[model samples]
Target: MAGAPEASPGESRLRRVPPAEVEAARMEAVRRYDILDTPPDGAFDRVAAMAARLFDVPVASVTIVDADRIWFKAIHGLEGVAQIGRDPGLCGSAILRDDALVIPDTRTDPTARTNPLVTGPLGVRFYAAAPIITADGHRLGTVNILDTKPRLITEADTENLADLAAVVLDAMELRLSGLRLLREEQERRKAEEEARTRAERDTEAITAFATTLQRTLLPPALPPVPGLELACHYQTDSPRDVGGDFYDVFSLGGQRWAFFLGDVCGKGAEAAAVTSLTRYTLRAAAQHHDDPTEVLDALNSALLLDPSMGSRYCTCVFGTLRPAPGGGFSVTVAMGGHPPAFHIQHGDDGAMVVNGVRPRGGMLVGALENAQFASRTFHLAPGHGLLLYTDGLTEARLPDGTMLGEEGVAAFLTTRTTPDAGRLIEDTIALITDLPTGPGDDVALLALSVPLAPATEQTAALSTARTLATPVAGAARADQER
Candidate 1:
């Protein structure tokens, strides 16, 4: 709202002032970057140096236009000069345009011929600069090259200087993203600490704290995927104790996605910490390498090597889904000492068949430094779905005093009429709810399926109920084959 700082004794002041609102917005942009008078950064210094060398100029600088002065974040070929005033036709003028500003000879340009940089002791002649613009159209600064003697440059040279500006903007964005993540983590930790303090005094507070803490470990809802349906549910055995079961569904780029479900070895705060680490490591690793096996291997290393993750291990199944040419999704799953996921399909006779999709020889993650994970690829055709769950479901104690086991789960799937993902989750939840004694541990379920197309002759027949064990012929056969 106030006027720009007055010019020094010899420097000419800015002749025109931007609208108050525009100046206010511009200053806000500068504050968000937090780049004013900051410590030197090697990456920025390199950009300034490269610009000077590439343009064969003696002076180059990465400047951030501040309220009172033009701050040099990085400078080359300029000694003992950290910044200069907002001169009329230098960086302050360059930042006003959308493209690069080039004056082949500053002495011949009417607007800048009298500027101090041209008339002062430096006796600058050539000046070229590209405005460093933000994605939202805020011109934050400039990347400029200057010469003591007049010179000319090709259009390509101007473009290259612009590219250097872009590089600077990208580095800033990446740094900003990291800072945001660090701040969020700190806030979450602070909230957790306050919750724990209150939990010690009130019984009700303990339950609410555990519930809120657990929600943070898992996604609130599954993301919608085109041509596919998704549903997930998590049930913890106790409200006062934190469970380590976690699952996530996220995009891996266009038309492809990655999902994972895992459980850490123990319960309470230690297990909760490991659960958080494992879930984030999987998401980060998927960005670099989409291979299910490689992603799991990265999690394994992260767990085993992290000093904070002592004695924690996990069983996980990581998988990816992509659109299939035949109107379904192609799936590839990798396992690490985890229970098998069930593939539910309808036969030509319309009989429902359930098979275990297990890749043998996958080891427990974080249990060993040299762990080997296994992967299997399969087609999730239309009228089919896959169900992944934690061991809590199979280990549930029945009224008859026997565990449900994998065989019991396969048998239960046959009783369902459809492979719809949401229905599968609902039925599974109901199954656990009806038990006289509830599940003994936490249960996390993730189901994905493609919508069945218009009724064809193949699917129009009367449906039957059946079971086929492919990857796992039977529980015993599975172990024998492995």
Candidate 2:
């Protein structure tokens, strides 16, 4: 710290205020900002860096005045006194100037050279001080530059001081914005954690009941289709983390069993709202249009009525598993923003699964007024098993936060294929279950297998199954009628 040149006898270049008045005004302005005695931050440190470079001074600082001391939020080439005695600070001198105060030579000036700062511990000789003003024009303090040797600061250095002060204000504003977002995120997490804790402590009572209700919302049991052995297994990452992940199997008026697996975008109640709406609507619309594409189209049309629902969308695979009139099963599936289904066929040694058709999701739900989906047809060979899963299974993160990607799913089916759904569900959650705090999403999978029947039972099964089929009375909403 050093004293600045005093006004000459005849003409004063720097704006001057009474020492007492300046000190009092400084205290009020600094307190108004409420940035006193705070921790160091990137925003404040950056001002010191810029000042050092722009002024070519060894020491640059943003100093604030409290009751009797000057505190430095940012300091360069200066240490020990985050706070200093208020008596003879170069910065205190700067606060008196509405503009900057530049002193080229301190030794020749009687007022500056005689001051203790010039001859005492600091040994400062050259100095520049620029007032730090609030938006309302109150000078809080100063951002000053200092050097040990006597030298002049250029006109450019003087001009940049005001500009650098403005930058300090902008930096402060940015820091406030970051703080606001951090608070919002923290509050949201706290609310969620409290709800989760409450739910976990009472699992068997309310938790079990909620799980039962969620289960009942699915089809009561897999539809008794003619030749298809269908069973679905769904397990969430955590019990209380219940979400809108569903697998359903229902009849489509004839030999067809319409099955689907879908997951709503978010977790908790909002997701469940959209999920419930989609499930019932798809079921109800099946009466009119049993095609997978048609059901999704109807769901899309329903969701678009909500404008704030850009956050709402579902990834679903909707398809029909029918005992073909002549042979195995004829499957026609359409996807809507969902992952593709994998089919495992019988090989000589064991069963092998491959993605015969790519992961396809037609139009993103709620994207526009009208979005379309196209359906694809394929044949399921004898003893083939079909698996449809949500991204929760594929993107499941491990303890290290790595995702269980397609490669991991591929390895699971290489040597282990059985009564499909149960094994699949067990393996999927094996890595995910232990994560109490994690990237938890819902897992919904449907497994449909058609085992080869003995010669005697084969002939009678298809005919008897057709006899069990209920006829469609109406076209519209007919698919949902069942």
Candidate 3:
């Protein structure tokens, strides 16, 4: 016994140190529950109370073992106490074994004699515990029972303690599964919110691009003309897509004005590109040519020359306006595979007359090598108006599923009592919007009228308008004969 080391007061001789890797894994299992130092629950408290009653012991605890301490999750009959140092004779030693640890007399047992629970104030003399083992073969801690006096217990009593340990493990597993489900739900909601934000941003970007491109394809505002009234309207089926319908009114010098309205073949960017070229080409051609027919011929030639036009063609009506020596406008119109322009005038009985001016034999622009066009010269007498439109209006479906064709337009125009350009555009827009199915394609409208003079001057203007109708009226009557 010489040079022997004395045992410390809180130490034990029964401790068996596990391999470093084994201990590390056990520690990790303890951390996985995250049960250390948490608030007490009534569930674990009830289990501990049952253990104490079944074994007739004064104290019972459900514990979790840490590296340096053993924490009590629930303790029955042990007040004002929560944890203690990791002594190998108690809960720490029980967790190392697969079965229950039983010491009937702690004071007489060499392994437990120096443990703090035996030497301290409470003087615990009997102790029994079973390790709470996970399915993966790692032990987290124990369910322990202690008494102040030494006593013997049967094998059946040891089995009861182990059953209580299994109860504690079940509670931990249920709590862990609930936490995992909550974490998964939070991640799902976060992903959906991110995808929704990205879709909104893409929609806004497309709208902005369509608006800017549409502006470049049409005139900002119609130019003002002396002794004449002009009005226009445009409508598109979708805000997100660029339409191919276009119109413009510009001066061609020397008291003459040029105007055109057309519809390209498709929708979206390609259609918009062709619309821009068509508008500018017509405007540039009008400046060089006095006749409306020559202006349209020039546009047809330009569309054929540009390779970028790419198999696209259009239907258009081009016209020139000059002051008549009588009292109205002398008008010349050229057509290229387009709808008839409506001529609204007053009859001999002062009733309204709506006539469609269809010059014969015009071919589609940009469709062939030598596409022919047709032209007509007419007298736009006072109290008369001309309406040019794309086919989107006539092609619109009615409530009866029938198309509102050229005849329907003529019938609508017949209801008007006076020639007013601005009122004509406003009423036309309202009609289109109130359609049963609305316009299926893009719609463009352009109207021109020479204002009527006062009652006394109107009489003189009428006689003058009739005299100017003589030579040009021959051309107008020829169109009617067709």
- The number of the candidate with the highest lDDT is 1
Kindly report which residue pairs in candidate 3 clash with one another: none
Off by over 4 Å in 2: 1-206, 348-351, 359-361, 398-400, 417-439, 454-482
lDDT of 1: 0.76
Clashing pairs in 2: 283-480, 286-479, 287-477, 287-478, 287-479, 287-480, 288-477, 288-478, 337-361, 340-359
lDDT by residue for model 1 (333-394), tens: 99999999999988778778999999988999999989999999999887788999999899
lDDT of 3 by residue, 1-482 (tens): 00111233444533367799998999999999888999986447756876887688999999998888889999998898887777544787777677888889988887677777888888989888889999998999899899999999998788768867876786676456435544644664665578987666656655555565566567766665666667776667676677888888788888888889889998875576567557766876676678877877866765664444567888899998888876778898899999999999888988889888879987888787688889998998777889999988999888999999989888888887776776676667667768888877777778877677622221211100011012112100000000
Task: Give the range where candidate 3 is weakest over 10 consecutive residues by summed lDDT.
Answer: 473-482
lDDT of 2 by residue, 1-482 (tens): 43444666644545565667665665676665567888875445656765786567788888776666678888977777678776666666666667787777667766578767678777778777777777766677677777888897667667677766765654454344335535655665666677986444444443443454455445545545556555454555555444777777777776766777888887654565566667766775665676778888877766664455566887777887776655568998888877777777656766665554553448765565677787898887556667777787778766677786777666766656553433544444444455544334566656666555522332211111000012112111100111
Q: Residue 104 of candidate 2: its Cα lDDT?
A: 70
Highest-TM-score candidate: 1
Model 3 TM-score is 0.53
Q: Residue 98 of candidate 1: its Cα lDDT? A: 70
Error (Å) of candidate 3 at residue 28 is 62
